[model samples]
Target: MMVCRVFAIFFGNCLCLLLLLSSLADANQANIDCLKTFKSQVEDPNGYLSTWDFGNQTAQGFICKFAGVTCWHDDENRVFSIKISGFGLRGVFPQGFKLCSDLTGLDLSRNNFSGPLPSNISFLQLQHNQFTGTLPPQLAQLRRLKTFSVADNRLEGPIPKFNSAIITSESFANNLNLCGKPLDNCKMTSTNSHSKVVILAALGGFTVTAFVVGIVLGFFCSTISVEQLLFRKSRQNR
Candidate 1:
């Protein structure tokens, strides 16, 4: 009876451990699918992202071999970080980044990607890219963001407000049109209508002032003429 009880306990523990491993594997496979989808969207001019291969499921450790992809654990194989930089990859920022729910660090710098940054990421390094567009205001909601950088991009408009302690001017350098708290204040880009309004306002003020001044001067001269004429008439009557 004692031997039977010990065997049952050991078997139960093994079963529980297997269940846990199976769950982790499923989650990691979902993450791999996300990466595979992301790889499909980008244009790899230099064939840098061609290293992402998901063709053979029977092959072991295929997902782990992807360029710039880092897995959480050897046994679990969950995506933890991505570091793909300086490859001249060009495209709109990948939407599949959101699918990596457990992504901690990301570095896609020195590429030719042109678009807005992803909203959900925490740690990001997107420096030296040709990205154009305003910084998304939703980025402030990423409370987990600690390491952030978007330097040397073609981005414009006011820099989105972020935690000053985490982001700074160095992160925004060389972005010609970007401005805000961490950087210089954005010089309001004057539109044609705005310029016209300012000019019209100045002209209107000048015209009103000149009209009032002319009226006052004319009234003063007329009063002086009347006084002079009255004095002449009185002297002639005398």
Candidate 2:
């Protein structure tokens, strides 16, 4: 009876440990999926991402072999950051980056990535890319952002307002059409204000002209009536 009890307790402990390990494995697989999705989105011309292979069990530790990938820990296998500078990649900002919930920092400078920057990415360094379009206001949601930069890109339109102090002139240097605080104060959009002013000025000028014409007509009629009365008196005297 004692032996049976000991065996039962040992079996239960083993089962519990197995369950814990299984959950962690599942989490690691999800991280792998996130990376796979991101890799599919980008166009790596120089084969910089060539080592990203998921075929062999030995390659399961993708964070170690993949270029610019950093994991949370050696055993965890969860991505922490990606700093792929000068990869010569071409594509829109990777929207799939949000899949890596554990991600903290990203640096993708000196690439040909076009389109808008992803709002989901906060702590980013995207300098010297071919990115175009307006800055997304959703970037303000990154409350934990510490360092941000996007200098020397082909981005246009107004830079989104951020409540963080990470943004500065250096972050927005060489971006021709990008304007806002810390840059050029964005050439205050005065189209609507100018239109309203023009309309009011035109109305005032019309009112003044009407008043002057009315006064001139009134004076002319009064003089003609006075002359007519004088003429009638002269005829009666004759």
Candidate 3:
């Protein structure tokens, strides 16, 4: 009975180990898919992404060797960040980057990517690009974002209010039409102007009413004083 119990314990340990390995394999596969989809969508005129070959599954951390990819470990397939600045990559924002579940830092600055940015990304360094359209309001929801910049782009409209001390006007420089906190306030709409006009008109009416009431009170008090003085003088004469 003791020998049977020992065998059961060993089997349980083996099962746990297999489960851990399986989970890691699934995560690594997702990372691989992220990179593959990103590469297929962009235009790499300079062949900067040519080293991202997926032909060898036998090699450990093969994806780590690809340019612009940063892995959590040299022998692991997990991606930590991707920085591919100045690569002249032209395309809309790559949506497949969401598959890299562990990605924390992303720097694609100085590229030719143009379009609305993805709202779900947490970190961004997309300056000097050709991206256009209003900055997505949903970006304010990324509370964990530590680094963000979209300067020198063609983007317009009210900038999202990201409540980060590190974010300042410099992070949004040269965007001709962007407005909000850390920048010029957005233009007041016609509705706001109308509200201001109504407020001023009410104040003016109140002031005119108060002035008329004051004059009436002053005239009435003067007439009462004159009557009292005349009555006293006539009583004294009698």
Candidate 4:
């Protein structure tokens, strides 16, 4: 009958729609879980990230439009940036930040984050915070690390060495006890050894060069004197 056939088609379509929706929901929840890991790590004052709504049933909505979050063009479901600067969040680095694999920018400046930066995050823009600790060299491991700034913090010790052109001396300025290249008087511990080795090697080279020159000069003078004396004695005998 036509009526029976219509019901069957309608039910089948509904089932397919439910399954598709379920799959999307699962992926969204996974992304939320990743974001939730970083929630407790920071101190949110103005609650700029309050709208994150980690428990929301839909994950695509998060990437589509979330407070202080940005997503990539081709990947709407994947976060690419989190700019929460000047929001008065007081805390250390967030957790599971690396979970946002497509993240290209993270601006946590003007907060009260007080501690060493997260090692996995290389391109951080922490303009102002209460951060205090030695710049961890582990951050240097981020080969994609392009920009780093922790100005106006209590961070001290050597500014972590990075081989990237994106980092420069001024990036870590306004902090206390930071030292290394590009910044005058902030020599890093690693560079000191290199300088010492260079000085010692140069001194050793100079000493060797002088010894060789002296030996050559002495050999020529001694030979000339012996030859002259022998010639004079031969001439006198003749």
- The lowest-lDDT stretch of 10 consecutive residues in candidate 3 is 54-63
Residue runs of model 2 more than 4 Å from their true location after superposition: 1-23, 57-60, 197-201, 208-238
Q: Whose lDDT is greatest here?
A: 3
**Each candidate's TM vs. the true structure?**
0.72, 0.77, 0.78, 0.62
C-alpha positional error of residue 84 in candidate 4 after TM-score superposition, expressed in Å: 0.5
Q: What 10-residue stretch in candidate 2 is worst by lDDT?
A: 56-65
Task: Give the alpha carbon lDDT tens digit for every residue of 153-196 in model 2.
Answer: 87777777778876888998998588888777667568967987
Off by over 4 Å in 1: 1-25, 58-61, 191-238
RMSD of 3: 5.6
Q: Model 4, range 88-140, lDDT digits (tens) per residue?
A: 88766776786666678888888777866666676789878888888788887
Candidate with maximal TM-score: 3
RMSD of candidate 1 to true structure, Å: 6.0
Give the local distance difference test score of model 1.
0.83
lDDT string, candidate 1, 118-197, tens digits: 65667889999888888888887788887888899988888777864879889989985888888888675779679989
Q: Please state the error at residue 173 of candidate 3 in Å.
A: 0.9
- For all candidates in order, the CA lDDT equals 0.83, 0.83, 0.93, 0.75
Weakest 10 consecutive residues, lDDT, candidate 4?
A: 55-64
